[model samples]
Target: MSPGLKFIDFSIMPVLLGAGSCRRFLKTRMLRKMTIKHYSSNRRSNSPDNQYSTIAEIKEKMMKSFGLEPGYTTEPKSREELLKYQPKFEDLPARSMQDSFSSAIIPLSTDAVLQDKYINFRGFARLGRLLEDMDLFAAWCCHRHLKVPNLPEGVPLPYSIVTVLVDRIDFTSVSPNGTQDIRLSGHVSWVGSSSMEVVVWLEQVVNEEYQKITRALFLMAARNATNTAAAPVNPIQPANEEEKVILAGGADRKKQRQILSAQSVFKVEPNAEEQSLIYQLYKRTTPVEQTGQQRLLPPNCIWMHDSFQMSTIPSFPEHRNQNNTVFGGFLMRSALEISWATAFLYCKARPQLEHISDISFQKPVSVNSFIKMTAYVVYTKENYLQIMTVAEVLDAYTGSRVTTNAFHYTFSAPDPVTEVLPRSYHDTMWYINGRRKFKASRG
Candidate 1:
């Protein structure tokens, strides 16, 4: 028999009852109850012992709470098959948002064997790993809402999904330990002709109450399985007033994105409003002589090149997803860490990710290629620090580099930040764009 084949016994069982047998069964039942009670008592709310003391304890608690394990069955059952144990029929309409709304509650955990790699320097869960999980959840949400293809049945065509952009992610707060129960919920916020907006929210459950922690907006695109072109998706009909508002917001954001893309500071010329602002900024600009402690001009101003930090790491196969490129979540995590570290050093205090916007995936980084990431402090406003991070693929032999991603982060520090000034046109472009993104992020 092949390893892929699993078998189940269908033979009937004969039952024999005796006084001693009944007593044994009762004893087993009582023991199981006592064990569960003991476990529950030890992990009671507000108990110091409830917290995870080590990685092994976290793994044990998560396994008992969520029963999560890697690897699925040899082949996954289709949505219809899993729903009713029936084969899928031909010519089905696209799925609806309600079909994709899913929720789960579980205590966070670190894999015992891979604990070091899954945690950041602060001993908390790595943002990159969480991102990977969120990406998977978003994909599943979209898949659940997809209509069955209208094709002859033999083998279904492969499904292709990619995350084109992450509009905004706000990290309000995070638990310091993995012992807290986290509630994850997501649904399709809006649908375009071939695109979808997935709103995923992460919250921590404390004392039977939910506390919002983080939320992210992801823009995903569906493509034809054969040609990899834009594929038609089911149109979403807003079911209620709340949904109507959410859909309207999504549409408005889409429109704003289109307009901004065309009028971005990266262009050669600025618009009338931007031109006026630039003129005022340069005309009133006071040149510092690179001296005087209280001047707050030259000393506070950090050059993009001087403030730039770089890290080189190889793209391992473990980071690849079904699309055969590096996972977006991993990239996000790595980029965020670098930016946070830079912010932390500059502020002389801890910095938290207040907002991340316009994370664009320009291209996929190939497996086995070296990824060189650069982080620069693009702008600063009082307590807010904006860092622009770029990820590129570096060819060692040719010494060539090609950009793969661009991420913008706004971090709030405990103390005020020394303002950064753009000395050149290129730096000014980033500064203007960063300010624009900051405004949009506020909305």
Candidate 2:
């Protein structure tokens, strides 16, 4: 075995068995042993144990293992080239849930060097970094579910799978220790013509039993090779009653998303209850006197304007994906970190992450671009805080800026946090939106 490599047998077959069954079990055990040996040999050849490997180095190696070349752009250089290869728009073969099921084990327990990449200052796993892993795992599951027609050998995939939304990520337990190994498993639960919903679970072994720590739902869209138009993907079929229920839930979520989009504040006016709530909030900051004067601030409330935190990061090539654009996972990690910082400063205590919802990737960020992330505590209820984080890409040449992504996070403060009071119409709309999202997440 490779240095520091430990083989863990997860099988739990009972010892007391009939003679006929015993022979079969012994055969199975021999096959499993051979498989483990082969896997270990591959691991030693591909990725030898290295204590000095940096995260970038490990990530580059991983991309290569996935058949993606680092620093290589697969997109067509010109519109004419993109037009040369037209994508077919035909029905694809239906796939079963089992076909897309996949799982991975991160050997943090045995790999001390690798654990350093994910550990935070407090010796606990960094949730933001874990988000990156989850995003990548979801993309892998999507790829596993898709199957294209006969194409040239050693050619790139004809479709570009991109994460469009993170429906929700719920933390069911406390942050895990860096010493425990992590198991990521999931499958493509539902699919539309060109969109898919992936469900992933993060678990760790506790007393030799796997315990789920987080469950995430991601919405991905498949685009053409050039990423200019939508591309159809294989449909997924349920194999049993359990899978059928899961598929139904995904369909319901899709409808709910459509409804929410239709009722967005930007598309339609707020309902009666929301309007009343906004007026009441306005009154809290307004003085009773009719004379024209400045608004009065509530004793225990903080103005939304004062609860803003901003950070600018220079995007590097190390964070770029195969398309030469910054990876979606890196964007998510950056936004989550900044939002967590904003919440910590606002509440004057360490906030525990409860839910991450409605993360929308509007545009892609190019390598070497400057990303400006702005976060604000938009709403609060009791000890809970709803934060809205916006990421904008700035052009160094034209000095122009464009919004790239928007992320929403809900956190529970150790103590009661000061309410965030809006001062302008735009802030009020954000407050209302945050309130709605927070309520939905809690439910």
Candidate 3:
């Protein structure tokens, strides 16, 4: 979208490009079948009654999963019905802070567990949150062009749609009638539709409170793309930040380099294989509850290999500050480097790798934090790779978080990338958002 402009949605739903032309999307068959899958699962329960996860049950499971505070009973709303306004956020009481998922929390009691710092838990929660948000964001973007309107921004994304949890939650201090600064630092390394890879670093500050989120920014990079000699006639574009620079150089060689400055792949959404992954991932994993809403979490599993260690230093000197601390630009640089590296590692299995198209900073991170970064190669095909990464900023002294972020990257193989075919999942998501009724498979 004009190089710098981007669309940022706070909820999870499929994305259709708002700043581009859907007509351009119609000419290609492979583009028609692309889908972004971020999470993974194998077992799904078909019991209609079972799909309804109670807030109490979600609370029990979450507490066990991440040491998070217990669930609170908010006034419940009727299901399958759309909302006309924002939901009321009632204050939760101190007693509701108990660990609902204690079986999962059992390990935290051991000396080895308390001091042991693991980042996988954050990855799980981040994956769930990103998928939920993708559902909303993507739907909203494509709503108008497809004849479906989407929810306005700044509203509460339904608990039925998205849920969030941190690895080490502290409610004992913040629960009891006291104001505390709740630090949430986490990152989703590689994300696609339905799943993600993430890590959460958290700390509760007594007498400190979390600032409510108000806005967000999304970034995309594309320039390096290799089209197969079989279809060499089709136009190809760059996919990585570096390729973009090279493209610009080539374009500048001929003229202004305007064409090369433009992004190659124009959109991001859930593809068929990705959708299958999502369906399978949630098929059996227990869901979390909040305000009487049942929300699903990524099933506990090792989807990405632990090949890289978290780095707090920037790869280059330009990113360091006067205090020798990493700057925000440096953090972003590190994030992309790590994400590309992780994606490259996964692509090695197939002897191929692609680049990222979009990135978003949910919040700011700082220096002196032993950041735990994770990335997932959620969606891959013959030549392209789509990766999502999450980075959590932490205060090493107390293991508290500075903030959270989610990034979406698109890569095209030596072949062209594809788009998703629309279905019921897309329709139901729109129905809940009070959007215009869609009649076609516009995915």
Candidate 4:
């Protein structure tokens, strides 16, 4: 949580806490059991029917989307062969925007989509799964920026890149089910001493035209494998005014983050402008006796931790990235899925992500570690709801847990929410900050 610490290092910390040691601090058994039950039910709702025709149909749709021919090579790329071609930073070849470009076509699994009364019927691609694809592409864009040549055998280059933040993602459209292909592409927009801002966009073909589904800004940091410390990233060369502008935007975002970290709303008193806004909010308040409105937080109001919570299956090999840790994109998707459920429950309608203010990976979660995700409705305004999801790793042996990732999401629902009122000063600060985010997003 210290400013000096860009992220938490779990390797140096004590082992995760045991379940018994963490019990009191966790949700009640009945609630947790229900959470698991609800998760299972959702999975069942989306499970595949195991029909051969269904699988074949999805595969054919994907191939067309990817523009792949029947005779295309299907052999797996060999890692050993790729490693032989690994190039050092300086030895890396020069690349243009097209050279750095890459894309993937994957079949959308039925089980990955969530069905809810509040969601639109046109499509059901889970936001978490969609984000996972976006993260991978952004990482690939950074890899190309480093100009690491492809190995003859498909071996990955020896280097490490990790996602530090998903600063923002604006969802512009939804990819429908009939439009099966999820297209992702990105390029390095800016570079710092050791950080690169990779901008990625998600798209799909609709009515014979490409529809942009989402555009995201991902902040990634390069590292040395030997020491696992920050390492310099390859600088980007802007070719046109558009690129130059994008590069500047990335730099500005970094500066904004620095300024925000230093003077977060929770850490300091409001300035004149912010104080004026707060005063306006207070002045607009009406007396409950006259307005016949609810006063204070209702006793039955939902607390963030009390509902829609679930722990992830232990991190596994299949989910590991080049760093041999759980993929950052996977974590992002996981958090989003749980937060979506939380928002849906509160709204009793469909909720869509409008903004992901930030996703800070405080610690790298190693493979096999257990993760518990908790979502809280920290603030709400009109039809927009601000949810914060915190991820922590539990040390089964030591019964210790350390917070690893914090994700802030803003969702817009069809209906206005029954506002969540803060009962304490700490809660009030968070509420005010949430409102600040809402206002900033509008601008």
Q: Which whole-number lDDT from 0 to 100 does residue 73 have in model 4?
A: 28
* Per-prediction TM-score to the true structure, in the order listed: 0.73, 0.83, 0.27, 0.69
In terms of lDDT, which candidate is stronger, 1 or 3? 1
- Where does model 3 exceed 4 Å of error? 1-277, 280-326, 349-357, 412-443
Q: Model 1 over residues 253-294: C-alpha lDDT tens digits?
A: 899889878887785577677778666555434444534333
* Local distance difference test, each candidate: 0.64, 0.77, 0.29, 0.62
Compare candidates 1 and 2 on TM-score and give the better one: 2
How close to the true structure is residue 177 of candidate 2, measured as C-alpha lDDT? 79
* Model 4: per-residue Cα lDDT at residue 317: 62
Pitting candidate 1 against candidate 3, the one with the higher TM-score is: 1
Cα lDDT for residue 427, candidate 4: 59
Residue-level lDDT of model 2, residues 55-78, one tens digit each, is 344455445533466444445243
Say which prediction, candidate 1 or candidate 4, comes out ahead on lDDT: 1
Clash pairs of candidate 2? Answer: none
Q: Cα miss at 231, model 3 (Å)?
A: 50
User: What is the Cα-based TM-score of model 2?
Assistant: 0.83
1-443 per-residue lDDT for model 4 (tens digits) = 11222243424533333322222111122223333454556655431222112323433433342223343223422234223343555654444343444444444433244234112345556677778867777776676676444434333344567898887677775644532655555667678767777777666566654466877888888775421566655556655344445556667788899998878876789778867755544434434444555334354354433434566558776676655578897898889888988889888897888888778888889877988898878777788888878899989899899999988888999977867655444655666777777766666
